[model samples]
Target: MTAKPPPDPAAPPRSPWPGSAATAPARPPEVTARRLVARSRIFRVEAMDLIFSNGAQRTFERILGGRDSVMVVPVLGAETLLLIREYAAGTDDYQLGFPKGIVDPGEDILTAAGRELREEVGYAARRLCDLQRVTLAPGYIQHGTRLVLAQDLYPSPAPGDEPEPLEVVPWPLTDLDGLLARPDFTEARSIAALFLARRYLQQAHQAPAADGKGRSAPGNASSPSPDETR
Candidate 1:
C-alpha cells in the first residue's frame, strides 16, 4: 500500500476572504438608479438637476464624492511600528490608527503623503514607497486612501497649526500579529495595509545583500540610496 502525503503546511485555512472570514450570497442590484436628485455637503442638501436614464427611469439622491487621502505605515528602529491616536469628531472619541490626511487640491500624492507623515508623526522619511490605494466606504462615502511605506525617519519640528492633537505611539512590530488578533483592529483597510507593508518589509529584508550596484536591503528600498526611487 502506498503511503498518503501530509497536507501542505503552508496552505492557509479556508475562509471567504483571506483576511476576513465572513461569507454571504452575492447581493443583487439594490436599485438601478438612473438619476441623481441632489448633491450637497454632509450628504443631504441637493442642488443640481437630475438626469434620467433614457430607457429605465430610476432615481436616487445625489451623493457628494469624498476626498482622497494618504496613510503611512511607518516602521521605526527596525523593530517598531508607529501609530497615532487622535480624536475623530465623526466617531466622537479617540481612535488609533496610522497617520493620514486628505490630499489638497492640485497637490501631488507623494507630497501630500510626506506632509501628512510629518504633520501627524513629527518625522520625515528618506524613502517613501507607494503601497496601494483603497476605497474606504464604497456603499455610502467615496473616500479614497493611498497607502504608503515610510522608512529612514528623521525628527522634524511638527507643524504648529495642525488641526488635530495627534499623539505618536510606537509598539514592537512583532506585536502586529497580536494586534490583528484583537477585535479593535477590525478596520479593514488599516489591517490590509499593515499586513501588506509587513510582508513587503520582510521580502525586502531578505533580498540579496547590497553590492556595488547599491541595491537596498530587503525592507529598505532606495531613496537616499541607489537602485531605488523616491
Candidate 2:
C-alpha cells in the first residue's frame, strides 16, 4: 500500500467544503455623479452614475431615506406573539405582520419598538431584546429596520396615525409554520424577524443558569424557567 505524503506547510488551509474557498470582496463601484430623480411624500429616488474598478460605468437608481424603523415581536406571555393586521399602502391590502413603525428623530431603537408595540397592540413590554438590523432590497433601497423581541407585556394603548384601527392578533410561537403559510404574512422583514426571534428564544432556553461560582445553578421549585419568561 502507498503511504500519503505530508501536507504542504506553505499552502493555505483547505476548506472543509468543496468549492467553498473564501475570496476577498471586490472593490465597491465609485459614484461619479448623483441627482434626485423623483420625490414624494414618503419616498425619494436618486440616480447615480457609477464607475466600477473594471472601468465599467452604469447608472443606478436607489431610494434614499435617512430614517430607520423598528419592528417589534411582542411575546404576550410564554407562547403567544402579538401581531398586527393593517392596510399596507404598497399592496393596497391588509398585511399581517409584527407591530412596526419608524423610529422618531432622537428616539432609540428599543424605545421606538416599545412605543410601536403599545400603539399597535395596546401593550408595553418590560423587556426588549434587539435581534438584528435588516434591510429590504439593499441593491435599490437604503432603508433599514431594527428587529426587536419584547416580553413581560402590560396593557398601555396609545393613539397612532393610522388611517383606521389596526387589528391585533395573538399567535402562538409554536404555530410559526401556520403563520408563514398565510398569504397576508408575506412581508420579508417580518418573516426574518420571526425566525431570528425563534432562534434567540431557543438559545436562551438552552443556556444553563449560572451562579457566582460560574457553575450551573440548582433548579428551584419557586423560580421561573426561561420558558416561563418567554
Candidate 3:
C-alpha cells in the first residue's frame, strides 16, 4: 500500500468523537458596539456588533443578565442517582433531570449545588466535584451552568420556590442508557452532565492508590470491587 500523506499542520485538531474537528479562531472578534434590544421580567436581550480579524462584520443578538447556574448529579450510594421531575414552564410539560438552580449573589458554586440538591431532592452531598462548565448556545446565549458530581449523600430537605413539590426519581448509574432512552430526560445540559460524571467516576476508579500499592483508590462509592463486579 502507498504511504499515507503527511498530516496538515494547519488543519484543525481531530477529536476522538467523529465529525468534531474544528478549532476556534486564534483571535476573537472585536466588539464594535452593543445595545439592549429587549427586556423581560426574567431575561434581557442584547445586540452586539463585531468585526472579525478577517474583516467580516456581523451583528449578533444574545441573551444576557442571567446568573450562572449549577447542575448537580447526586450519586446515592455506589449505583443510584437521584433525579427530579418538575413542570417545565418553557416546554409546558413535566421533565426529568438533575437538580439545578442559579447561584445566588456572593454564593459559591459548590455551595449552590449542595443547596439545590437539598431543595429539590431532599439530600445533601458530603463530597462534591466540579466536573465542567458548559454553555447552552454560545452563538446566541451568554448563559453557563456548572456541572457538579455529588456523592456521599444524606437526607437534608429544605424549602424551595417551586410551585409544587418535585418528584424524586432514583435511577441506577449502571443504567445510563436506560435513562437516556427516556423521553422525559431530554435536557441537553443534564445529558452532558451525566456523561461528564460517568467519565470522572471511571477515571477515579482507575487511578492509582496514594500508598504506592497497585490498587485503585479506596472509598469511591461509584467504584465496585472486582469481586463485587463479578
Candidate 4:
C-alpha cells in the first residue's frame, strides 16, 4: 500500500516509490572544467569538460540554474484540478499547465506554492502536500522542481507579474486522459505531477482512517480533514 500505517512524527516516511530490478549504474564522469559561456535575463549557459571512466574526454553545454521551482496540483474540492493557460515565451504560444513559479531566495517550497496558487489561480490551499521532487533536463541542466499537491482551496487572489491575465481552467480529474490528449498540455513536469498526485490521492483516500487517539481503523469513511472545517 502507498500509505503505510502512520508512523511516529519524528520518523520519516517509509513508503518510497517502487523500485525496478535494475539498480542504478556507476557514477557519472568527473568534471574537469566548467566555464560560463553565456548569460541571459533568466538563464545561464555553461560549457563543461568531462573525462569518462574509460578516459574519454568530452565537452558539453548545459543550462546553469540554481533556484528550486514548485509546480502545484491545485485541486478544487475532490475532483477538479486547476490549470492555467499562459503564454509561453519559449514556445511562442499558449500552453496549459498547473500554476508554478521559482522559489524566492528566502522562501520555502510551501510558501512559494501558496503564492503561486493565489497569483495564478486565485486560490489558496489550507493543506499543501509535498508529493515528490522532479528534475528538468537532467542530462543538460542542474535544477530541481518540487511537485506539490494543493487541497482545501479557498478564494484568495494576489498580484502577479504576468504581462497578461492567465486563463484559469478547472478540468475534471477523471478526464486526465483527455487533458493528456490535448496538443497544448505538453509540459513534462506538469504531466509527472498529475500522475504522481493521482497516485498519492488514490492511496490516501483508500487507506484506513485514523481514530481519535491516532489508531488506524479499516474503513472507507474518511475522517474530517483540515479542509472539512473550512
Estimate, for each residue in 74-162, the C-alpha lDDT of model 3 and write its tens digit. 99998798999999999999999999999999998889998999999999888877777899998898989998888999989999999
Q: In terms of TM-score, which candidate is stronger, 1 or 2? A: 2
* lDDT (tens digit, per residue) of candidate 2 on 14-106: 566767636422556778899999999988999999886568999999999899999999888888988899999899999999999899999
TM-score, structure 1 vs. true? 0.67
Q: Highest lDDT: give the candidate number.
A: 3
Ranking of models by TM-score = 2, 3, 4, 1
Q: Model 2 Cα displacement at 158 (Å)?
A: 1.2
Clashing pairs in 4: none
lDDT of 4 by residue, 144-205 (tens): 99988889899999999999999999999999899999999999999999998887777666
- After best superposition, candidate 2 residue 183: deviation in angstroms? 1.3
Q: lDDT order of candidates, best first?
A: 3, 4, 2, 1
- CA-lDDT, candidates in order: 0.68, 0.83, 0.84, 0.83
Better of 1 and 3 by lDDT: 3
TM-score attained by model 2: 0.82
Candidate 4 total steric clashes: 0
lDDT of 2 at 147: 88
Query: Which residue pairs does candidate 1 place in steric collision?
Result: 204-218, 204-219, 205-218, 205-219
User: Model 2 residue 152 lDDT?
Assistant: 84
Candidate 4 wrong stretches, greater than 4 Å: 1-27, 212-230
Prediction 4 TM-score vs. true = 0.81
Per-residue alpha-carbon lDDT of model 1 for 188-221, expressed as tens digits?
7778889878877776665566785644455443
